[model samples]
Structure formats: C-alpha cells, structure tokens
Target: MTTPVEVRYFAAAAEAAGRGAEQVLLPAGTTVGGLLDLLAERHGPALRDVAARCALLVDGVLHRDRDAPVGAPTRVDVLPPFAGG
Candidate 1:
C-alpha cells in the first residue's frame, strides 16, 4: 500500500464529508489537484462541491498549485471559506 496522506476537514467541509479526517492512500508523487480529484471521487458530490470552495494547506503552508507535489506522510487540511471572511 502507498503512504497515507492525512486529510482534515473543517466547518462546512467536514459536515459535507461527514467526518473530520481520514487517511487517504495515494501513489508516490501525487499532486494537490490529483488529491482533490481523488477526494471528490471517493467522498462524493457534496465533498466535491465543498472542495471547490476550500483552501488547501499542506503541512502548514498554503498550496494553490494543484500540480504541486504532496509529499508522503503529510497533512492536508481542508478549510472552506467562512461566511464573512
């Protein structure tokens, strides 16, 4: 099995996902966009819609590049836009 990426969901994202976190296994050298795609596939349309409005933070750094690599044994936090923010 491939190394698991720690995925964390917050607020609306968490509610849509129906969970706070999960271990997602992806092959070596997967990117943020790839991860999002996989998450949308595994988590369903609710999550997919939530994901589009979410910001991704890898480890502690903001990642906007979907093609950017997601290192193994890492943490990816899913944060959606706040109501007023």
Candidate 2:
C-alpha cells in the first residue's frame, strides 16, 4: 500500500528541494533511508548532498535511525547543519 507523507525542508535543504514543503506518496512501511533515496531521485544530487549533512525529524521528534519505518500521514523535517551558535 501507498501512504502520504509531508516533507519539510529547511535552510539549504529547502533550496535544494526548490520548495519549503511538499507531499509525497510512498510505499507503506518505507524506511527513513528509503525516503532519503526517493527524495534524492526526485530532487537530484544537490538535495542528496544536502540531505547527507542534514538531521531528520519524524513527526516532530528527531529520527536518527535510517532503518526506522516511516508511517502514513507523517511529517518529516530535513534540517541542514547550522554554523553559528
């Protein structure tokens, strides 16, 4: 089954994606890693590079495990590294 997810991009991530937010349809039980791959495919290498240095938040909570499953109707935030304190 396919599910809908909201992806919010921040900083360089937003620039790479060319938008601050978008909705995507993904297979049910797709992992965080899978989502990253899909995003890269859709947005190209710029986004892939930015995403590599980004921190992901799933449903408002930080998600570090790429293997973790991303459920339906979820919100994912991609935050790029910040230089200043």
Return the top candidate by TM-score. Answer: 2
Candidate 1 local lDDT, 1-85, one digit each (tens) = 4787789999988998899999988888788888888888988999999888777888888877778887774788988898895
**What's the number of clashes in each of the models?**
0, 0
Identify the candidate with maximal lDDT.
Answer: 2
Question: Candidate 2 on 1-85: residue-level lDDT in tens?
Answer: 8878889999999999999999999898888788888999999999999888777888887776788887764788988888871
Clashing pairs in 1: none
- Local accuracy by lDDT, each model: 0.85, 0.86
Off by over 4 Å in 2: none
Off by over 4 Å in 1: none
